[model samples]
Target: MDKPVLPLTYEQIDHWIASLQPELAREGFTHAVGILRGGAWPATLVSHATGAVPAFLRYERATRTAVWDSSVPLPARGSKVLVCEDIAGAGHTLADCVSFLREQGLVVKTLTVVFDDLSRMRPDYGMDCRGYFALLPWERHAYTDRYRARWQHTQAGTLGPIGEDHEFAVYAIDLDGVLLPDVPPHRYDADLMAALEERDALLPFEHLPQIDFSRTQAIVTGRPEIDRARTADWLARHGYAHLRLVMRDPSRHGEHPEQVAAYKAEAALELACTHFIESDPVQAIFIAQHAPLLRVVWWDAARRAAKLIATQAWRGADAPTP
Candidate 1:
């Protein structure tokens, strides 16, 4: 349970694509097939940096429950398949993709991305520059039927550019200002916390008693590892069993130390999260691909736990107006 899921700043992780370009050329991946959606952006960055324009593939989500929709339009033959994902947690998706590529007879020689932690199998090439280390919720956070029973956004509309299909919303604040309370467990706002408590299902946990969390996600970042841990632990106790700690292990990828810092983006994208919260303005300013669609929340109060602020504001659709 002592997971080291670390959060990464966008600025701290944006340089990974350029750094990994040399690996692509060395691997002879002239035409690369990037998995769709999440992989598209990183693939684009890689293409721009390496001048490999037509070197990306767009894979779709699996329609089947058993199989992940890696709808990749791979070349019928085979070249150097670089399966890219935001985070390499457990390698479930990564491994699936590798197998999928191989089935097509397309030689998947290397796996490249911002973060590659061998949750299962090892990638031909590992470049985790973003020292950002956190447990991906989908992979670690507990799920439950009760949590799913409360549907925030039904699969009724389009994900658009924001990826609304993931059924997640954004709530952001600063570490030094908004998240820290006047007390010791000062990561969450005391007042807002009371609001969160009103609905226990919202707390991070797996296995909803009656509902299915087929599509729901969350993304949060703190100043340092300790602050993040404090908030994370508090949430877990309060009913956030679904909170995943993105742990950063140095031994995992010895080849690309620089990539360790860039893996934060992987964490953000792993949960299929479209929104984010942050205190540092610079964190989102530098990174080109990971910016935008980002809503910056200036911490009105600093509480590590939860505060009873305007609950309806954060909860949006359901939070009471009290």
Candidate 2:
């Protein structure tokens, strides 16, 4: 099953950081040590808020090591310091960093943007984000398979598996008009077999949507399942074979716009996809209506733009027509 995702916006992160200011001031920290990469942002903010000297430590996750920056000389022994991190997952980075700081005789208190209940090292202060995969605004690419593989590699022999249930954004995208030029319905109606063959031969669209194929989990298409072989071949040839393809069931539904929309909506729900991108505006509206919680985006192929279709406005009888 796909993990549930908690998309964190800048406003939300700023608010979280702001909430820590009062306590940070009370702690009377002399220095704010940020773990590099993810931790640096929050550490800088903490420094700004608490008027503490900002310091950095480069942490290597794979090697489980932390090295202090050469320019920032070590703080005097016994000085109060707050270590900041973005998130405290089941990792050894925080523990190792804190241990290294304490070894210098500095008083170390850990702070993180978020920490799960199952985290190996709970921060002295953090937003309890148990069970959800918190997607940070700056590190949107962190959820990709490659990133996960790296995480898994470093986490081997750890407490729990990374694939365990957690919240994460799952994206489902349309194929025909979104990924490639759509063979007009008229052409398909005129010569179904010939149009199918032509579509199979056509290359991907030049100005496709700015979707990260690595993060995209599924492709929900209106094409019938009988065409899976050709569809899979097309996707593989175009370097998108890793994505799971959900094709229309010819035995259950016809090629009507409404039927197609329903099929796509059902597929999105079954896949637990948080976002669905469709090329047809009408179908986009229909899918949003069917799955009110699902985020739907209408991809304009010509303009190469994506417009989010809000489902709330389409909920009641007073809903505006598309």
Candidate 3:
């Protein structure tokens, strides 16, 4: 049986942070270092509570080393530093971070919300974890991106090869916000390109409960064709493989944002799937307007909620006149 996913709320995080007050009440800590993206929020919370200066320790995947960003100077000699992470699953990240801090000649302490039983490295403080995957409030974007099953009887299985007359419900899904959290558009710069090239970022989003990959007919995404390799790797790692993925052909349409909507609408119309789950509200609305016969379900990443947008069964008479 698949393990049930436990979604942790902000209130739960606040409670856990409160529980660690007794352990962190000591007076010697000079700085609180966050382990980049995942650790930033909790570290900030700890810093706010304890009055410690906040800093970042970024992990370089290519080098497999954790180093301070140099923007923030290391603490004074013999100063105590508290490190925070959202979880200590597999123990690799925190372990590497602690080793890096120790090498810098600073006293180090670790804090994590969830501690996996199988992790080789134990944290200085952690809450008891009870699920295969713990979705932190900060990671809620992922939970919202997953396809929630409305048809429970649909068994999980792979979509057979295309061009065959397969008699199964096909769901056309948007990639970024629907199946995985989309990277913030503002961060599309040289740094983002570097991260992609390093293969250290763009990790796969965890699927929510009731999501069966076999139900996916085709993934129509706005991501450029250049990202095909990394996107494929991420999908395969997350158990989505051998399915038709339609990405924007930048060579033909260029990177005009408007072209993305047109491409997606074209794919949805061509597939004529039973449903299309989309993350972008505007795109979802566009799909509903263009493909009135197709049901559109909206996955709100910000609110972590799902809503049925539009649905109209198509008849042969309703075919578009070209």
The global C-alpha lDDT for each of the candidates, from Candidate 1 onward, is 0.42, 0.82, 0.69
Q: Which stretch of 10 consecutive residues in model 3 shows the poorest summed lDDT?
A: 144-153
Residue 30, candidate 2: how far off, in angstroms?
2.6
lDDT: which is higher, 1 or 2?
2
Q: Give all candidate RMSDs, comma-separated.
A: 16.0, 7.7, 20.3
How much does candidate 3 score in TM-score?
0.46
> Ranking by lDDT, best first?
2, 3, 1
lDDT of 1 at 54: 44
Q: How does candidate 2 score on lDDT?
A: 0.82
Ranking by TM-score: 2, 3, 1
> Between the candidate structures 2 and 3, which one is better when assessed by TM-score?
2
Residues 108-220 of candidate 1 have per-residue lDDT tens digits of: 65444435343455556555534444422222221122222332232323322222333344222222222233223332355655543433323322221121223324434
Ranked by TM-score, the better of candidates 1 and 2 is: 2
What shift in Å separates residue 21 of candidate 2 from its native position after superposition?
1.4
Work out the TM-score per prediction: 0.41, 0.59, 0.46
Candidate 3 residue pairs in clash (backbone atoms < 3 Å): 157-214
